[model samples]
Target: MIIKRTIRPLFSVIFVFAVAAVTLFFRAIVSGAGRDPYPDQNPFIISQTKHIPSLFNATLLKFSDVDLADASLRQNVEQLVDGDFLSFRTNRQRSFLSAGRYRLDIGVRNVRGSAMDLRSPEFHQLRLDFRRVLKDWWRQRRFDSEVLSKSNLVNALKGVKYKSCAVVGNSGILLKSNRGEEIDRHDFVIRLNNARIGGYERFVGSKTSLSFMNSNILHLCSRRGGCFCHPYGEKVPIMMYMSQPIHFLDYAVCNSSYKAPLMVTDPPLDMLCMRIVKYYSVKRFLKETGKELESWSGLHGGTEFHYSSGMQAIMLALGVCDKVSIYGFGKSDTAKHHYHTNQKTELSLHDYQAEYDLYEDLVNNPQAIPFISDKFKFPAVVIHR
Candidate 1:
């Protein structure tokens, strides 16, 4: 045991060296791409129209080398998954329909079954009721009044140069390194269920950007005991979004895009739901006019498969930026025991690892510039050095 213990230090040193080498190599690759000359444009914006966008189709794959200038192709893909973008509902019926499209029913209501044949009539009736509720929502959507304004956000971002932002998950490791400040310093910072940022000023620091947490996280509150991880209750981000003033850009990427079993934000059913993210791509376009686009798949509507948890943030990322660096994303192998944040947004009844692996594969396999924060797991702050 002593021998192993003594050798363990040596092994850890070598491992760290390898990681450092990889980091350097990765940075070189990233910086080289940075220097490759801006492609005379920004991607992620679409041509605005009077009517809603229509869905084209969805593939299991994502494209890193997408050509952004092709508006028609981009628009098709977006229309397909647009249905999953920013749904929130209040009632059980509304929530079920909003979320059900993305959830594949596998068992008879045991786990989500791929086939609903075995579902009880009660379940079938529930599904029907939810479907009706969604249709009503769709009808109400036409009457929705969306308001978007450009503010001084860009100026607020003076001296900030992170073109690619990494949205971190709430794993406990952030507490170790005081990553909150580091995250805030990034050109852009998106935190998922940003629960424990309050009072841990040394750790969380001055977070300027927005968060993407749902009502459940708001209700349950993600602060547990001791480790800044848990199921404690407190005020949440939704209220902030409701009250905060304009920056050129400020938003909370909704993780539950497809599952908007919406509760009325104000009184009156006449008041439609308003989310800034629905127009994220447009904002990207407004920021940079000339960049070519990749796929605009997210602009439309589609079947249930489109809106899974954590998908919204990525989709929002896809709509606005060319190169993306995902942070706080949990690894497929260790999702259940994810050591980052307190609560994980569950996307399915199936094994989380399998689904997460699939999601990660869809991103990395496409050769996108993935600054995956999930790969390195350790104590406290891992300063970029």
Candidate 2:
């Protein structure tokens, strides 16, 4: 009897230890490695509880009643498109006014003035993480002597004050719009992805002030082994935004090889753009902001976490230009992917809808000095001629 009791107690003790081990393992899995257990200890821009699925569902319920075809334009959008336009131009203004706040809160305005310092201490703090990655890439450069003499990227556009700027996208809608003359009239013209402008110049304009592209494009171009120069014309400057650390190598090489003026995006500004997208993603997809500006946009929410190149170019224009005009932005029923080629634009990759919303917001914002449509011409209907 005594032996049986002793054995039972020992078995019970072992069972207790086994249960504790299992509990600890599950807890670790849930919390993630090196993460604090308490919610208070982990602070984020948006609450963690506002999960993507819930946010998307809420967005749908809020805008279920709105008609996609004939909805009124949002208070922010100045231009009116026909109901037949490919994407719904409904006034789905987000409650979060992040665009203006981004410039004001993140000190994007500080980059202006005579001395545009890229290596300032304040600038460094904002892009510290990106700077670290860049430093690593710089160390791996084959020829360190090829480095730029000037630290700032703004030197490329020195003594240039853009009074009116036109940011042109590759959307096929430009082909039919016949807005090339108006686009060429702008003081400065910005294009994305080194888009083709040879024959399309009549539609896209011939003037090329600045072009924005990511490093992946440069790397791919270099790998393709083509003499793919002069996409932006003979001597136009380029702003290459680094998407990864390895991109710095391609950038350095391009700087050495290419005769045209080339510049890189400052890391702080890059991060600031990222945060602005995050803010919009939350406001449009997750929050209870019940503002219905579109009929079918919520379904695609939580997919695009990054801003489009066109949007980034527009933001850059806002920093430098007195007035900004966007051309060839939205999709249309008859329009192809691009005006230059037969290629199709992937919608899932970038948040085009959100970017479109911002365009409308810029129109409504009175404080903004830049007029989106100072003498803008909308597409005209043709009866016979």
Candidate 3:
């Protein structure tokens, strides 16, 4: 009886240990089943079991047979699985129809596709209309053809390409930075609106390879005696985009006597700038606020809404320079709207925040930029505060 009692307790202890061991073994196996196979590889890879639902939803949204066949879509799905909420939302918007309906068609596509082609019939008509207006003004003024030909910017810059270019803006943040020497180091330096550089050369460089201005600035300059627009010296090239249709008269008068090239922006290039800025502005508006796209015009000036000169200069630099650096392109509450001017308020027309977002995207992921052709290779960009 003593041996029986002792063996019975021992068997009970053995049974308890056996049950515990089996429980732990199964728990370990189940835990390991959801673990990452290569924990050290690809930090963006989805590892947590909780995120499986999100992964599955994204996969379902993107996983059509056609999309599955596309290797790029597969890569995009992998990126989506890593939780890029903004991109995911943008994809959701694209994949869904109006009024909460869904569409099965899915593949990698730009949120807004490329701008109108320069060779398209619409562009040709635009060019013709622009030339007709300019020619009508030229006939009234009897402008010299020889002088106009001499000042042709496209001809002058036909073979010209810069290895490095700096596009300097007039934001008041420039006053806080001593980037003059750094700005001057570029192969070419482009200044906007002829911002004053005499007393502020330490903060803004004195070197000026090109001056980019809007038609309004030139019109104001035209009011002066001799139409004196040479803020950056007479030898510096000036590129201006038309702000009003009547500005061609100012161009005709100024280009006649200007020693350096004074050229209007190409019609196609102007259209391209317009489309790109609008796309960015709309995207930013939708992302930040609950307002609809139609409400954008009312928030921004209705007919007066226009891109700033700085944005267009950056776009021009992207096309002509191998490396582009942006300086003095931000705003602050304590700072003046322009470093050289007493104006303390920004104009309502420019969406500076959207432009800044564009600059960030340009620096971080140029491939994600919308309304630009894939055939155009984007230059390396850096933004200086």
Candidate 4:
């Protein structure tokens, strides 16, 4: 009886220790401790989330009954229905605005319109074909004839290199810098997200050669009457990267009305930008925190994290410009988030500090940039305070 009692107590103690060890193991797995998070799939490869739908498939065919009955909404519906003609007229107006400017030899063709009326059978059929082309692009990332006809960005940038380019960001630090003339001196000036330039011309230059934007900006414009999205005048060429698949429909509708070049970033270039930014962000996270890679997504809003528009602009400038100068890409604790707005906090989705680090690397050590192919010859980069 004494031996049995002694053995029972020892067995109970061992069982308690085993339970504690299992609990710790499970906690480690849940917290992504002591493990590589993305072992099965290569983190470098672009992976599509199954939860996010590829297309929104918004209806553009007919107006709702409620819209027709309301006179106030009737005009907007009519604008949607007559988008093609309005777009043609807008294009003509933009052409007029661009008159006598030093136009590029790039083929900026006039959009041809049929004599058939908007409600006519032929016109509707043409619209259907255009919509199909947009859907195909979203699904396959193929540049069809319609896309080529509407956009001259590729042709304008092809084989021609700029001597110097300035990429301007919207950070409020620009208010402190009286570098407008300096910014305008570059051969080409690229601005981001339709930032205001009216009263702030002394800080941000009056000249804009190109406007790079996210698809969200265009989507917002698509909601307005006639899709009036010309904040930097109607003649400046626009290059935008798609942020949402639904914005493809926005492009399809608004692109018809744009006079100057309106183009989406090619899939290859978009993927390259994504990979480079991700690499920098991940590297920063690992170095600064000494944390496992698995914990990064949880802290950074998972798949929602994205590079800022300024980063993409810099990448494009690197490819096409001989020298790139960046301005207004920094943040200060006291400064507002944007010079043109009252917003003070940075967006949670973007890691501005990580992007600044990237800019620093680009300026000081171009060879050290990771994930870019060795074939790419990075141009000289300078960042201005």
Candidate 5:
């Protein structure tokens, strides 16, 4: 009886192993059949020339050589296990690459209006509408003629030429990441509002080239009864964006009280961000997913659409830096909202899912790497070089 029972259990184990082996064998056959024909041609690498150098000048795949958008989406869904989110990533990446190659020339006499410039006259005509938005923002700001003329909006980046940049978000996923050395090695580092590097420098890094914040945050951080009089460290430049008329008051305080250099985002630039959000809503969601975007006010419950400060930092980095690496941008179920604060925040105040989609898109970008992890993984995305 004992021998019979032992043999039965052994048979069960062997049967299970055989089934798994058969399954894997068929899976391998399917994958091999559908694999990319040109393994050496990577669409991720952005080059200016139409002719891609091959050992034999062989006909390699170009961005148009294959339906890359579909291929990337498939891979993202199979590997990341999120279909809709990966769809946004694939779409956004394609949109970015369609406009221009990955380099941003800081010293050029004139920067392109859109990172994705079009040679077609039709596109140029369409961009005039965007120009109107900028015009409206400029007229509304009503800056002192002298101040406006003397000040160069992007003068903070006048002498700066960064090969690499790290845009650090406030997400708690960075708590245990020992990536301080990796972050600091970059030529420039940017942080968002109220980002605390103290005591957590080993995890979040200590360098700050530029810091971005909106008016409401500035008011709270600088006011007499506010939580923090000076949240950011000295010598780090502040880039403040306008949200309300009250922001003007906060801007004044920051300029006067804070010894660090302060630059207000130009009306055109600020308006451009608004337009970008609108563009995403129209193209990314309504058309692709058949889903509509929901608007959320701040924690206080107001009535305007809000963009996360992390995304603002990312857009800014993409405009100036040659390559950008995003850290502490995504949140897992187990992680806290903010790394520095013990108190949890109401995430519903912003469109976090949509923003995460954008970050995922950037992660798949060849020039941009985003760090996302569930566990306390040391490095999130492996740098190929």
Candidate 6:
């Protein structure tokens, strides 16, 4: 009986030790390397995609219903159809706003008539084949309190008078171009990703009055559940409202301010305000009130990026800043990566001669400002490929 008691006690002790050991080992595993129970924490801007399917078929016709502003003239775009007008491809990316190294125009033209108005039957046949080229766009999602945040920079930017801004593209050239200090000297500086120099006050000076970012970028740089390049603590002032006001996972996240800064472009920043946001008027929106504007957009929300780099450069040159410089834009027909950030999609070869010709026509138009770039020399874009 005594031996049985001793055996029982020994077994009980062994069981207790085994339980404790397992708990400790599990805790150690949880605390060890490769233990990443955390969320995405990259310093790049990555808005979790809505409207777009997480996994899309490599081959599918994609079209954008979003507006392209000046890129798409109000007049329906109709011209010669040589069986190839435009096409879209999303093999490894959610969207390609512009074609990469290859010469491709990345946008949709609003044609008033149906897809069957081309002169030759080949045109109609081509349209059917290219249907997937015109059927993709980011959709609008409801503002989930748990998932979305409004523009905090906008609310904090009251009474700040920012006149000019320099949006520095972080091309490899920026490292050697010697434009760093000059870019920082401007009233504002917009840099993407961590880009090293953003926080180095010693290198680039103070924060460039306001920073402009897209949703994909903001999500990557957020700290709560995102990246932290500008770090979410110190409040940056709000500047002009950006284009493609996507709040609804449709609205943008800007600071509210009473004294609105100078809008960098025309048609007004308030025009970019979400239809869902209340106090949507430009006057009220810029008054620095911390109120959400009533959403005027339908369920689909505005998911298009209306301003291309060229368009934004033009907008800034014409409205925001007195002088403008271009860098890190337009590859040499060989530097084929479409985006500076982490976009895995490849651009399709779509003939945009019609669009390019259209742009050229505008340049020669009588109403265009002859010396538009002012004193800057815009190298003639060799588009004869």
Best by TM-score: 4
Expressed as tens digits, the lDDT of each residue in 1-385 for candidate 1 is: 9999999999999999999999999999988755524344232222122331211001111232122223542332233223321222221211212334243223222122122342467445544443453344334432212110111222223323345555555444445555555556565555555445556556545453445544344322211111111222212222111110100001111212213221212211111111112122223333444433332333222111122223344433332333345544444433432343455555332233333433454454422112222232211112121
Per-residue lDDT of candidate 3, residues 112-214 (tens digit):
2223344566435434444565654333322121221222332545546789999999988999979999999999999999899999999988999999999
Ten-residue region with minimum lDDT total, candidate 3: 60-69
* Model 5: per-residue Cα lDDT over 1-385, one tens digit each: 9999999999999999999999999999999866655576432222333444221112122211222123443343343222122233333321111222222222111012222234455334433433343344446543221221222433556644457888888888888578888888988888888677889889988888888877556655543332233555666777867554323423432354456666667654544444334333223333345443332112212334556777777766655666778888877777788888875764553556656655665555322211111121121222211
Residue-wise lDDT of candidate 6 within 302-382, one digit each (tens)?
333233333233223223333443334333334423323433332221112212322343334312211122343332221
Worst 10 residues of 1 by lDDT: 242-251
lDDT of 2 at 4: 100
| Candidate 3 global TM-score | 0.62
In candidate 5, where is summed lDDT lowest over 10 consecutive residues? 55-64
Which of 1 and 2 is ahead in lDDT? 2
Q: Quote each prediction's TM-score.
A: 0.32, 0.53, 0.62, 0.64, 0.51, 0.33
* lDDT, model 4: 0.66
Worst lDDT window (10 residues) for model 6?
A: 247-256
Model 6 stretches astray by more than 4 angstroms: 1-164, 192-207, 221-233, 238-246, 249-306, 309-318, 333-385
lDDT string, candidate 2, 1-385, tens digits: 9999999999999999999999999998876844533445212221223443211233332333222222232211212111121122232221111122112112111212122134577434424433454564334322211121222323456745467888888889888867778888988888888888888878888888887887656655543233234576657777877654434434543454566776776644454454444434444543344444442255544323456777777666665666778888888778887778897766574667656655665566322211122332221111100
lDDT against the true structure, per candidate, is 0.33, 0.52, 0.65, 0.66, 0.52, 0.31
* Worst-scoring 10-residue span by lDDT in model 4: 56-65
Which lDDT value does model 1 have at 98? 31
Q: Report the Cα lDDT for residue 117, model 1.
A: 47
Candidate closer to the true structure by TM-score (higher is better), 1 or 6: 6
lDDT of 6 at 207: 48
